[model samples]
Target: MKPNPISVVTFDLDDTLWAVRPVLLKAEDIVFDWLEEFAPKLTDRFTAKSFMKWRWDIYANYPELAHQISQLRTITVQLALEESGYSTAEAKTLADQAFEIFIEARHQVLPFETAIPMLETLKQHYRLGVLTNGNADIFRLALGQYFEFSFTAEQLNASKPLPEPFLAAQAHAAVNASEIIHIGDSLEHDVIGALDAGLHAIWFNPDDKEISADVTAKYHVNFYQVQCLSDIPAVIDTINKSRLHSRVTSP
Candidate 1:
């Protein structure tokens, strides 16, 4: 008559839940079309290379805003427009509209085939949450039903690879690090950062990539990892049973 030891599990949204590349590519295309129609003169001067330069420049100047990708992107567009000969006020207005277009398109993602079917089952066992660096809105996509809370780098002011978000998750659950686990695609951001913050981690390695030299050290010993989304339920069961057994056997 004991409660589950693993009370919470947080997930990364972009590459973990869906393929990010196609969505981003489509979002970029949407933005390009919007710009051509709304600000033809700015589009005439705009190039991908120049857009990247402007974005990186914003990163350089405002390192504190580094984790807030939405703001960074908005400012990038704003600055690029100003440089392309728009008045500052017009630049800001057009930049906001351009970002609105991009963000709407960004949410049109195709979740991995296994993702939704598995979520209801997982939610029965663990209080699930989302922790993402990207700006995808779960509520808009109707994915909020599967999760109890959602955290974003934009809101946290700290992305993955930093301990802040993981620590925040631990605090949100009001539990020790051992009671929470995170799963994501990035070895550096997901596994390493979670472990560094003392939370358990699982690498959702759908691509079947090998762990690079340094990441293989302590992480392999400390956490459960999976190569496919379909494998997650079994992995979580193993972790839950292992934790339960340890607690029962402990003196």
Candidate 2:
């Protein structure tokens, strides 16, 4: 039988509601251009790809910094300069400059075409919220109105795949976990994390990647699969109808 209708719907910001790669690429270009112009000494050591690699490596090494992307970017720039033979003071200055350039550039966001319309539809029927590991200020990009609440790992000090952030989102939304539906692209982070927190999850698997054997092996299950934002309303209707039937049949 189908489960209860979701009363609250929380979404992952990056790659789920929007196409983040283009915005990130534009941000990187702006940062690199600034570094090349103002901090030419640091430019030689830091390329965008290498910078991203180093940032991810640092996040992996210091799991505590997982939600601190800004800090990770800053440290990555500093480390790149030091590795390329710059002194500590010089690296620090370059890192600060790079971070400023990146942050200002990142504010120029281009939300996906479907994002606003879909949110408008969902907002009418369900409480809407955001669950992310990114900087909280990201809402300043002009997508804040649709959500009644937004929670990030930085605020909770715990990233996804850990249940804290999801639970935190539930608290912030003032909704029970079972009544919340989470939508995200990452199987490990979104699906597993929401499930761990007892929220219904929907895998936004636009890429058509086969379900992993490991996920299947663990017996993890999601409430639905959505290939596009347009599919959401239908899925919600299905869930609601099933819930109505279950209620009617209960002894």
lDDT value for candidate 2?
0.79
lDDT of each: 0.84, 0.79
Q: Which residue runs of candidate 1 sit more than 4 Å off their true CA positions?
A: 1-4, 48-58
**For candidate 2, lDDT tens digit of each residue in 4-106?**
6678989888888777778788888888787678666656766767766766776677566767767777877788778867799988988898887777777
lDDT of 1 by residue, 39-107 (tens): 888778867556656667667887877887888888878888898899999999999999989989999
Which pairs of residues clash in candidate 2, taking residues 3 or more apart in a chain or in different chains? none
Model 2, position 149, has a per-residue lDDT of: 82
**TM-score for each model:** 0.94, 0.86
Rate residue 181 of model 1 by lDDT. 84
Worst 10 residues of 1 by lDDT: 48-57
At residue 87, give the lDDT of candidate 1.
Answer: 94
